[model samples]
Target: MSETSSGKPGLTREQLADLSRHFDEDITFSRHIRAKVKEAVPGEATLYIDVQDFHLNGAGTLHGGVYASLIDNTMGLALISEVGVRTATIDLNVRFLGAVREGRVTCRAEVVHRTRRLATLEARVHDDLENLVALGSGTFRIFEKQGRPLV
Candidate 1:
C-alpha cells in the first residue's frame, strides 16, 4: 500500500474495492463481519457493522468484547483507508452507553488526529434502533509489514 500526494492512501477506488475483498478473504476472524466505508479523507474514515448471534454473549446479548472489537475494527479500518498501511491498536478506551441486545449494529469511526508514527480515532456503536450502545477511542501505531496487511 502507498500514499497519495494528499497524504491519503494512494489506492484508487478499484484498488480499495479489491482491498476490501482481500480483507474479507484473508481476515478469518472478521468473516462473519460486514463493513462499508461511509466516508474517507486524509487520515480519516468511517465504517458500519451489523450485529448477529455469532457476536452475542452467553446471555444472548451483544457482548462487551464484541462491542470493543467492533470499535477496534472500525478505528483500524478507518486508519487503513486513510494511511494505506497496516496499523495496530496501541491503546483502546471503551465506554458502554447502553445494553445491546439483538439485531444489527452500526459502528462509525474517524481519525481524530495523527502524526507520522501514531494515529488516534474515535468510534461509536449503535444498535439497529440507532441507539448508541457503546463509544470508544483508540490509538494505533502505523507500520509496514513483510506479510499481507489485514486492515
Candidate 2:
C-alpha cells in the first residue's frame, strides 16, 4: 500500500467518497444536526450545518453540545481520511467563544499529530458571518475491527 504523509496507508478517492457517504447516510446524529460534508482530504475535513430552531438552546443560540459533537465528529473524519482506519474519540475539549442564532455554521478539523494507535486534532467552528464560534481539540484511539473495511 502507498503511504500517506502520516506514513500510513493512503486511501484512494473512491474510498474517501464511500467513507463520507457512509457518514452522511448511516450516522443518525450527524444527519439529525443537518451536518453535511463540505470537504475531505488527507489530514483535513470540513462540515457545515444549517442552523434551525431545533439546534438552539434555551438562550436561543446554538447549543454547546452541538459544537462539541461537531468537533468530535469532524476530527474523527480528519484522522480517518489520513489513516483510513477506524477510530473513536477518547477525549474531547470544546470552548465556546461566540454565539450563533441562525444561518450556517461550518466546522473544519485537521490532524495535528498521529501515532500507531492515536491521533490528535484541532477543530474550529465559524458562523456564516465569519465569526469564530468555538474551538476544540480531541484525541482518538485508532483500532481496526476484525472484519470491517478499513475505510
Candidate 3:
C-alpha cells in the first residue's frame, strides 16, 4: 500500500470500514468478544465492546487479558488499515491504567510510524464514562499474505 500526498493511507475511510467488517466476520476471537468496528479512517480505527459478565475476572473486574487482546487487535487493525498488508506482532506493551466492571469499552488505535517491513502503533482504551483505562503500543512486522489463509 502507498500513502497519499497528505500522507494518509491510500484507501478511503469506507474501504477501511469494509476491510474491518471482513475481519470481524473472518476472525473468530474478535467475534466471540463482540468487538465491533465503530469507525475507520486512513491510519486510525476505533473498536468497542460491551462488557459482559463473562468478560469479568474472578475478582469481578474487567480481565487484564481483555485489555491486552483488544489493544493487540486494535493496533493491528490500525496498521492493516494503513498499509493493507498482513502483519505479525513483534512486541507489545500494555499498561493497565484503571479497572472497569461494566459498560462499553472503546479502543482507539493509530499508526504512529511505518517503514518497508515494520510498523508501530499506539492505542488507548477508555470506559463508557470516557475515563482512560488502558494504554498499549506495539511493533508489527509487515509481510505479504501467502497463497491461502491460515486454517
Candidate 1 ranges beyond 4 A from true positions:
1-10, 32-49, 144-151
Model 1: per-residue Cα lDDT at residue 17: 65
Better of 2 and 3 by TM-score: 2
Off by over 4 Å in 2: 1-9, 145-151
* Per-residue lDDT of model 1, residues 11-42, tens digit only: 55555665566555566655556545555444
TM-score of each: 0.79, 0.91, 0.88
TM-score, structure 1 vs. true: 0.79
Clashes of each: 0, 0, 0
Which number leads on TM-score?
Answer: 2
RMSD of each candidate relative to the true structure: 3.1, 2.3, 2.9
For candidate 2, lDDT tens digit of each residue in 1-151? 1465556565667777877886777788998887888887888999888999999999999999899988888998888887777788999999999999999999999999988898899999999988999999999998765213443
Candidate 3: clashing pairs of residues? none
Write candidate 3's Cα lDDT for 1-151 as tens digits: 4565567654555556567786677789988888888876667888888999989999999999889889998888887777676779999999999999999999999998889899889999999899999999999998866211221
Computed on alpha carbons, the lDDT of every model, listed in order, comes to 0.72, 0.85, 0.82
